[model samples]
Target chain A: MTASMQSSVGNPADEKLGMNLTLRIWRQKDPSVKGKMVTYKVTDISPDMSFLEMLDVLNEQLIMQGDDPVAFDHDCREGICGMCGLMINGQAHGPQQTTTCQLHMRSFKDGDSIDIEPWRASPFPVIKDLAVDRRAFDRIIQAGGYISVPTGTAPEAHATPVPKADADAAFDAATCIGCGACVAACPNASSMLFTAAKVTHLGLLPQGQPERDDRVVNMVAQQDREGFGGCTNIGECSAACPKGISMETISRLNHDLLGALRAGARPKS
Target chain B: MKKAVMAVSGIVMVLYLIAHMIGNLKVYTGRDSFNHYSEWIRTIGAPALPEQTALTIIRVVLLAAVVAHFWAAVSLWRQARRARPERYVTKKAVAQSYASRTMRWGGVIVLLFIVYHILDLTMGVVNPEGHDASPYDRLVASFSNPFITAFYVISLLLLGMHLRHGIWSATQTLGQSNRRRERTVNAFAIVFSTILIAGFLIVPFSVLFGLVD
Candidate 1:
């Protein structure tokens, strides 16, 4: 077996090698309440376990001890959902580009101290411990992220032939799972990457061309309205993004925005 | 829209800086050649369009670019400030460069330098030779003072820092940059800014050391 697989908790030999980690996590009762770092210790963590699973083990221990367990947002336990995120040791979604759920315990060594915090943007106010409000993203999407589709009948798959290059580009932008890591990592807390990804995902296709002008115009307007910081083109967002979304996506959004404005496009009220 | 405005205006300013540097380099040829070029600029549109008309137009365009660039920068900066009222307790730099992060403050210093520069050279108000002397004589006199030379050199260095990030960001803002050419675009900025700033600095340094006279 691979070394990591052999280190699973069921194996008695791995128990001696199990890591004891120190976690300093942010804890808040509610949005109005003040938050602070609260430290906890987890013992005998299997190298094969994920980061979130370590937290799970901590919470299970807490429940057994009749103490309030730390609250966090998570689902799927897999990377694709984009539902889980944590500022692990000052990095978005931990030290790796993958989501917190995908980061295994083996990524760290025994006796390591990890600091976990929620997304820090004002637009993403802390909800509890590691969860923050990201509904602002939904509003930006509602503003113009959708294409106008005819609801009467389903369009044929090959009805419109998309170029090989554009289809790939669209798919690349489409991979953004609305995770708040981009905002967390950005110095200005700009949502440029998220909005740009959505804008370019649709902006690249032929079907997307119809609303391309309005899409860029309104989505950007909504982005500004949400009080998210403007993009300084510092590239922290793309760097911290788990999907590996390219900076070109934001560039494409800028190009579309300029063209839209020159064409006298206005955001819908 | 604002990003485009900043990008376009920044390009206009950089293009003018390149031309300005090349024109300033005429000092090495001889005082007569340098002064002659300055005089030639005043009469650029002499017969048909009238003297100083082209120069005035160029000045007006540069002024417009500066105003537009400043306006966009301020609005975006204010929005950015409002967006993140709070900050992370432990935020670390991942991919951002020191030059990129220093753009805002560095741009302000560069702007101050431009004002001082125009007063000393273009207006001759701060030059020892004043408005009555030849352009070459004024330059030589101005750089002869160690303080004047120091300020000029410092300002040019700051301007170079601003341009390094400014030019690179302009490409990204204009959608000319991509993942594959990230290094290429960045190196282009570093190389162009270094050369342009070096060209300008050499003229002043030469004058300070008595090479231009």
Candidate 2:
């Protein structure tokens, strides 16, 4: 219902019941062209409307006026898809500890000048206004983030006999949605959390034991190769993650990486 | 791989600092006691080892640690710098602690200070009494001057800040820290760095106040 809230369109500020707000949004025509914060006034925004819904209202206004609509990515507006994001007022997913799609407009007061920018990182290049190319993340995942399990019938769930603690921990790490919010929030734009999540998600599993050494080494190499910054363990990535991925996953990655390097592991690629 | 190098080398240096701070507290025992302590460092494992063999080993290890630490830090710094060529137009603080943000530049400052420290204290090139003086006398001579003492204090403060973040970060890098133990690890870093730095700082302050002199 957050995305479905009605805005009193075209109504004067005093006549409308909903809140009026100013948006300072990053508007870039393309990756080659420079971007700037283009301010727009949105009126009669419903308190129940999600942050994206508010933007939706603005984009509607722009389209009606023959102006190019603001571009932002979204799929499941329920926050789990990790498709929608923005640096709403300098925060990765706005002020709330949730995805931009899930963040309700109620968090802001009337007359607020919200600044929306795309994820800022060298690797995640801004594709357009409020949307960045997150393929750097895809490359990182491709770099040994998977186990070499042969294509066959699905194995029995109980066959693995995973320890309860390990299963719980692995599940925690598996929640990382590969959203670049971690990179955007990171001071160095490091993808440690995202990489670590992938590393540890399978790292703690019994099936992950075979390629453990190679996985850590190759993935880390690819991460560096993609021009992502090194991790300083600032804990910003985990803090900004929508899935609430714990920093412990990063520790596990570090531990695995050290052991792999000590054992002289190299990339299978 | 680079983070591991930094963590390992940083841990080595921290271990040495703890021992150095403990030995530094011997200054309160008078000049002979402090001088004997300095000589005692060399005489460790005496019967089986050649003169200064132990000290030489420690120096070699410490030197290796410093070099490795510097190499890792610089490489990581370069990577970080290159990672974000296009800076955020809306500049905002992302790091949790001021100490965390200062690790890179502060480490460089600490390294530069180390060179000055070695020249002044160990080599006695910048020491008022010169290298021939007893270790205690050299120590007293450096702290006796307001400018020298001031430099030492400033350097130690900066080193403390570096150590504060470095300790916690090393744990994170080494996978020794976790969510449940996060607060404990944080407090341990703050407590240990403060105590160790204070132990080192006490001697210079005492000397400057004429207590150790």
Best by TM-score: 2
**Predicted complexes: DockQ each:** 0.65, 0.62
Q: Model 1, DockQ value?
A: 0.65
Clashes of each: 0, 0
lDDT digits (tens) for residues A38-81 of candidate 1? 89999999888988999999999999999889888898887888
Q: Work out the iRMS of candidate 1.
A: 1.3
lDDT of 2 by residue, B1-213 (tens): 778889999999999998889988898988899899988887988888888998999999999999999999989888888888876666455446878888988888889889999998888988999999999999999999999989888888889989888988999899888778888998999998899889999999999999988
Docking tier of model 2: it is: medium
List ranges where model 2 is wrong by over 4 Å: A1-17, A150-153, B42-51, B130-132
Model 2 interface DockQ: 0.62
Return the TM-score for candidate 2, rounded to 2 decimals.
Answer: 0.91
Best by DockQ: 1
Best model number under lDDT: 1
